[model samples]
Target: MLFASDLDQTLIYSHRSLTPSSKADPILPVERLDNRDVSFMTQNALKLLQELSGQILFVPVTTRTILQYSRVNLQGYGICPRYAVTSNGGTVIQEGCEDKAWKEQVLAGNVNCADVRDLLSKFREISHPSWVLKESDKLADDLFYYCIVDREKMPYSELDDFALWAGKLRWTLSIQGRKLYLIPYHVSKKSAILYLQEKEGLSTLAAAGDSLLDLELLQQADAAFAPSHGELFLQYQMGVFTAKRINNQGIQFTRTSGIGAAEEILRHVLKMLD
Candidate 1:
C-alpha cells in the first residue's frame, strides 16, 4: 500500500493552531521555518506516522522547495520514507537522494509549459514592492516561483486576475495563507505519485490534503480525504470538488484540523488496512 500526505497545514500546523493554549497540553515545535516561525504536529500524530511508516510506503508530498522541505523534522524512531515529492513534483527524492530520472521527466514533460521566467515578469507587473516580501521570493530550481505577500495590503481581485492570466498560459496559481505559488500544470503531486506507485508496484493509494494542489492527488487515490476548512472543503461543499471513490467508504473530512485532522486521517488509514 502507498500512503501520500501533504505537509504544511495538513499534517503539520502553525502555532496559531494550538487552540486554547492555556488548557491544551504543552506542544513541541518540530519544523523551524524561516522568519523564526515554527510548525507543530501532535505527539500522537508523530507516533502514528512512525507506525504507518513501517507498514507501507509513506510519501511526503508537498509544494515546498527542497530547502524548505528539509527543515521539517519528521524524524522519529523509524526509517525515513525513501521518497518525497517536493517542488510540487518537480523533484522526487528517493533514499535521501533525488531520483534524477524523475527530475528529467518533469522538465521534459513541462517543456511546453510557459517559461518560468515569464511568471517572474508577470509578478513584477502586478506586484507592489512593499506588499511582496522580497526576502521570501524564490524560484524553485527555475521550475516555479513563490513569495510571501502582505495579504491585508494586497487586493483579492489582483490575485484573482493573476490566477486567470496564469491559467490561460497553461500555468496555475494558488494562494496558501500568505504564500503564493505559480506552477505549471504538468508539474504535479499526482504525476509523481503515479510514477512512484508504478515503480514500487504499489496496489492501493490513500491520500489527504486541504488545497487545490492536493485535489487531484486525493481524487486520483484509491482512498482519499480532506479537511473541512480549506479550499478543497469549500469547493467540496459547493459541488465543485468530489472524491468519494467507489473503492472506499468512510468520513470524507476530519472532525477537527491541524494535529486533530492528522490523527483522524491516520486512524482512518489504520482502518483501511483491514
Candidate 2:
C-alpha cells in the first residue's frame, strides 16, 4: 500500500501540540530548525513509522515549502520518503530534488496560475501587517501564496472573508496554526496523490491528517483517518461528511490528537492491511 500523510500534527508535532508527559523518554524529536528541535512523535509512534517505512511506499504530503520540509530529518529513522509532495502540490520531490517537468505541468496546466496570482495580489493589498507577517508571506513557486500570521491578533472575520474571496477565485484558504495558506483548487494534495497513483499503478492507499487541506486526500483514499483535534473533526460534529465516520468507510476519526494520534493511525493502518 502507498501511504500518503501530512507531516505536522499528524505524524510529527511541535511542542505546543505534543502531550505533556510526566515520564521521560516518551517521545522522540524528528524535525529541527535553526539547530533547535521543533517537531516530535512518541517513541512508539517513531518505531511504528520505521516499521511502516519498511513495509510500504511512504510519501509525505505537506503544505510546507520545500526548504521548510527539508528541515525534517527522517533519514536516521530508516524513513527515507524520496517522493514528497511539497508546496501543497506546487512541487513534487524525487530523491530530494524537484521533478521539474512535473512541476511545470502542475504550474501551467493543473493550477490556474494566472487567476491565483491576481487573487494573491488582492490579499496582499488587504492584509494588515500587524497580523499578517508580510515577510513570511511568499508565493510558493507560483502555485500558491501563504504567510505566517499572528493568529491571536488576526480577526476571525477577516479570515472568514478571505476564505470566501479565495473560493470566488477558485482557490482554497487553509489556516493551520499561524500559517495561513491560499492555494489554487487544482494544486492539491489529493491531485498529487492521484498523479502518483496513475504513474505507479498504486491500488490500496491509506492516509492520515488533521486539517482542511487533507479532506480531499482522506475522502479519496481507500482508508483515511483524522485526529479528534482538527478543523474536520469540528466539521464532522456539525454534520459535515458525517457518514464517513458513521459508515466506517473512506474516513474515520482517531481517539487521540497531536502526536499521540500519529501512532494510533499507523497501528490502525497496519491492522487493516494485515
Candidate 3:
C-alpha cells in the first residue's frame, strides 16, 4: 500500500516543536506562517499518522526547497516515510537520504533549459513587485529552480496576478502556503509518485493535502482527503473528485476519515487488482 501527504500543514505543523513547551497545553504543532503564530496539525492527527505507517507506504510531497525543508524536525509521527517528493516534483528524496535519479529524468524531459531560464528572468524583471526583498535560486542537490519573492512584504493579490500572468508563459506557478514557486508545467506530484510505483509496485494508495499543487497527487490515489481549510474542498464541492474531511480531533477521526469514506476507495482499488 502507498500513503502520501503534503508536509507543511498536512503532516508537521509549521512551527514544528519536538515537544510541548509547557505540559498543561495542547500538543499542537506550531505553524510559522506569514510570520504569524498558527497551529499546523492537531494532536490527534499526529497519532493517526503514526498508526497508518504500518498499513501503507508513507510519502510526503511538499514545495519546500530542500534547505528550507531540512529545518523541520519531525519526531513523534512514529514512522519515517520511505519516499518524499520535494520542490513540487523537481526532486524525489529517498527516506533518510537523497535521490538524484528523479531530477535527472525531469531535467532530461525538458531540453530548453537556457530558454526557460531566460523567460523566467524576464518575468521576474517585468511583473515582480517593488518590495521584492530578494530573488534567489534554490539549489537542490541535483536540481535548480528559483523562488519568486518573500511573503513578508508581497501582497497575496499581487502574487495572484503574477501567477495568472506567469501561467500564460507555459511555466508552472504555485503558491504553497507562503512561497510563490515557478516551475516547468510538466512537473507534478502525481508523476513523481508514478515514478515510485514503477520502481516498487504499489498495492494500495491514499493521499491527503490542502492545495492546488496537490491536485495531481490526489488524482493518483485510491482515496484522498483534505482538511476543511483546504481550497481543494471548494473544488470538491464543484463535483471534481472524491474526498472527505477528518476533524481537527487527531488520530481517531483521521482514521475514520481515511478508512471510512475512503475505505470504499480502497475497496475499489482491490477490485481493480482482482
Candidate 4:
C-alpha cells in the first residue's frame, strides 16, 4: 500500500497553526530554519508518523519548492520517506534525488497550458500592494507562482473572477491561508501519486491533505482524510465544497485540529492497514 500525505497544515504545522490547548500533547519541532523552529508536530503524532513510515510506503506530498521542502527534516525524527512529491507534483524526489524522468514528464504535460510568465503577469495586474505582499510573490521552480496576501483585505470578487479566467486557460487558483497560488492544471498531486503508484506497482492508496490542491488526490484515493483546521474543512463547513461520494465513504475528517489532527490521521491510516 502507498500512503500519500500533504506536509504543511496536514502532517506538520507552523507555529501559528499549532493550536495549543490545555490537554494537548507535548510537541516536537520537525522543521528548523536559520536556527529557529519553523514547523512542528505533537510528540504523539511524531511517534505515529514514525510507526506509519515503517509499515507502508509513506510519501510526503507538498506544494513547497525543492529548497523549501528541504528545510523539513523528517529523517531527524526517524521517519525518512523514500519518495516525496514537491512543487505541487511538478517535481518528484526519490531517495533524496530528483527524479529526472518525472520532472521531464511534468514539463511535457504542461506544454499546452498557459505559460507561467503569463500567469505571473496576470496576477500582478489584478493584485494590489495593500493586500498582496510584494516580497512574498514568488515563482516556484518555474512551475507556478504564489503570493502572500492579507486574507482579510483580499478582493474575493476579483479572485473569483480570476479563478474563472484561469480555469479557461487550464490553470487553477487556490488560496491556502495567506498564500494564493496560480498553478497549471497539469501540475497536481493526483497525477504524481498516480505515476508513483504505477511505477512502484502499489495497488492500494490512501491520502490526506488540507488544501484545495489536494482535492484531486483525495478524490482519487481509495481512502482519504482532511484535517478539521484546513482550508477544505473550512470550505466544507461554509457549504462551499462538497464531494458526496468521497465525503460519505472514502474520506474521513478528524474531530480535532492542529497537531492532534495529524495524530488522528496517522492512527486512522494504521488502523485501516491492520
Give candidate 4's total backbone clashes: 0
lDDT (10s digit) by residue, model 2, range 184-263: 78788988888877767888888888887888888888889888887777777888665363235857788776667888
Give all candidates' CA lDDT scores.
0.81, 0.80, 0.58, 0.88
Q: How many residue pairs clash in each candidate?
A: 0, 0, 5, 0
Task: Write one digit per residue (lDDT tens) for candidate 1, span 83-166.
Answer: 999998889999789899998888786767778787678867888777888778888867788889987888778778888888
- lDDT by residue (tens digit), candidate 3, 93-211: 88756677887788786673434656556656644555443544453333435554655666667567666765666566655444555676657788888788777797556666767
- Candidate 3 clashing pairs, residues 3+ apart or interchain: 15-30, 15-31, 44-250, 44-251, 45-250
**Highest lDDT scorer:** 4
Candidate 2 runs further than 4 Å off: 22-25, 110-116, 150-165, 240-250
Q: Compose the digit string of candidate 4's lDDT tens values, residues 1-274.
A: 9999999989998888855481376888888898999998888888898999998999999999999999999899899899999999999999989999998898787777888777767777779999998788888998888889999999889889989988988999988888999889889999999999999999989999999899889988889989987788988889886754444664688998877888899999999888
Displacement of residue 241 (Cα, Å) in model 2 is 4.4
The TM-scores of all predictions, comma-separated, are: 0.88, 0.88, 0.67, 0.95
TM-score (C-alpha, index-matched) for candidate 4: 0.95
Stretch of 10 with least lDDT, candidate 4: 242-251
